[model samples]
Target: MKNIVAAVLAGVLSLSLTGCSVFQTLEGQTEDKPNEYSNVYELSSGKAYVWEHDGETDIRNDLSQDRVGDPVFFACPLGDINFKGDELSDIDQYPRSIWIPSDIDDQIPTVTSKNALIYISDTTVPEEIIFERFADYGYSIGVSNMEADGGGHYFITYAETDEDDYKYYVDMKSEAAQVTEFDTIARLYLDKVGGMEVNEDTVSDGGTVMNLEKDKSYICEFYTGTFYQDFKLKANIHSFGKLERFVCHDYEFLHANCIKIEIPDWFKSGYYFVQGVGLFRYVTDEDLLSYNGKAFDPGINWNDPIKQYDEYGVCIFDPSLDIDYEDIENISDPGLDESEIVIGASPEEEEETEGSEIDESSEGSTLDSDSN
Candidate 1:
């Protein structure tokens, strides 16, 4: 059976921590939190979660559930995978809502309209992640942006036909581009890519197919709304792998299900997905050909394309063990200048220990990270 509804996307950004033990539960990390976002922080195997803010739509309210599963833990596969977290001082440094593996069960505190109470766990529950036709998949409300010059970039969704309609879609005369809002651009792109008149109230469900059965192929229209881009992809689930654990970097995701999707015999690229986590891994025939001693890109003649699908495979987060932060500040002060704030270390402590040797970074550090 298929369920249809409006869906949202929340991109996953892995956090970089030093050598830390796997899966460290933060007991009192939220003790000093002042708001719901800070107070309800969770510690899980997720390194870090990065997402964009869409309109006032709360994804949890509009989540489509074909089965009695936890839709609140939905994840999207588009965001700044390159997002760098300077320090883990403030819990609000990340997205409003997050999913963390936990053993605690209780009524969650109410978050503001701008915040979401989305949480997830790696525990394998009886409910399955069902993919339906026209239903809105749950993830945090991720928003995308269209450049002022009519240039649009998307990840999860690609154009079905190579039409130069992007120039026609944009109104160069207006100060704000014709495709300003995320939904407007998303629908327009979806109409072209998914080959459906998304503007129309009723859409034709001609090629929509999704049962999520292993080794079974199904043609489906997948929609993605992430921080950088919001669009749809029309592809076939070539095969569904058995539910297993997906370990990336220092974090491990339990009950991780894999789905192999492709664009039939045309595109030579492969997209992979996890049940709870959206698109986690991707592969390409070009890289495969090059790995097998074939010229992948003749122009560039790039042989070692960073990854050859064998060394570590395609996991979302980079396996490097380095901490990175970019213009990080307290969530409350948006205009505050970026400072070098370390987790569990105050300004005075940082200054005092500037030249002194400190202990190594570990999972049991100050603040734990979360995923979408």
Candidate 2:
């Protein structure tokens, strides 16, 4: 009787050890399974390509110059810019005004043909900085040379917002827009800030670029205004530091729909956004000549030919050759994969074990028959 009892106990112990070994082997197989995600690079002929790198995928249009996206229409800080004739009246004292010439003098430093318009603003900026209105092009260009003190400064320009056709963009801020169709070259000036967002907390005071990490620089800032009267969007831009084929490469342009403020009311200002490039503090009129290195013409026409091209000799406003902007979806963030590990026995395995019937060929069945 003692030997039979020892044999039964030893058989049961061996089966238990075998079951644990099988479970461990199954777990090890699961852990060795290949990851589902893999790197994929798909090129659509030569126009565009989808590249997956380090678990992240990016889709870019290789030929993004043939088409231009429509501009976001926000009210200019000057409200509706009016053409107040050629001269500034001594009696009419406005806060901010500038004389933009349709015909300028190369030597006289004045409007030669007396074909000038006065652009007056009431909402933003000091008298030192003025916005030149390009009537034919239907936009305003502003520049500043002020330092970024505690209050901050900005240089920004945009298309006309008061036109009845663009009433849709009057109140839009921080919204996504689709480029349904290809636009003309004339539309480039109007398409300054595409898909841009400016919140009330936008920081204006430019931070130190040296303190920033590699390949990073200050873009723009949105901060609460002085006396809490208004919110400010200050953009510090530098243009053409590097010569490149595309104007987009000259400066880091942001695309977002703004919120709260209709126009960026720059108080303390520096830098300027114009001709698809951000100008630094000390920009002269000669610096605003042609896109490529055209000699400075003092009599440069503000609206002679609205279209500007890059050094690559391609139209700046041109969109991609094959793909449309509507088809390209905006991907703000990348999706991350998650995994879970199970310990001991899984719930399903435990349930199966609890409900399992005794096997007739097993030692347990033999032990039961012997007992009987």
Q: Identify the candidate with maximal lDDT.
A: 1
Local distance difference test values of all predictions, in order:
0.24, 0.22
TM-score of 2: 0.14
Q: Tell me the deviation in Å of residue 178 in model 1.
A: 5.5
lDDT string, candidate 2, 160-216, tens digits: 232222212211111111111122211111111212322112211111111112222
Each candidate: RMSD: 28.1, 37.1
Which ten residues in a row are the worst by lDDT in model 1? 132-141
Error of 2 at 18 (Å): 70
Per-candidate TM-score against the hidden true structure: 0.17, 0.14
Instruction: Give the per-residue lDDT digits (tens) of candidate 1, residues 111-211.
Output: 22232323244443323332110111111112111211133322212222323222222222221132333342233333232233322232211111222
Model 1's TM-score against the true structure: 0.17
How many clashes in each structure?
9, 24
Candidate 2 shows a clash count of: 24
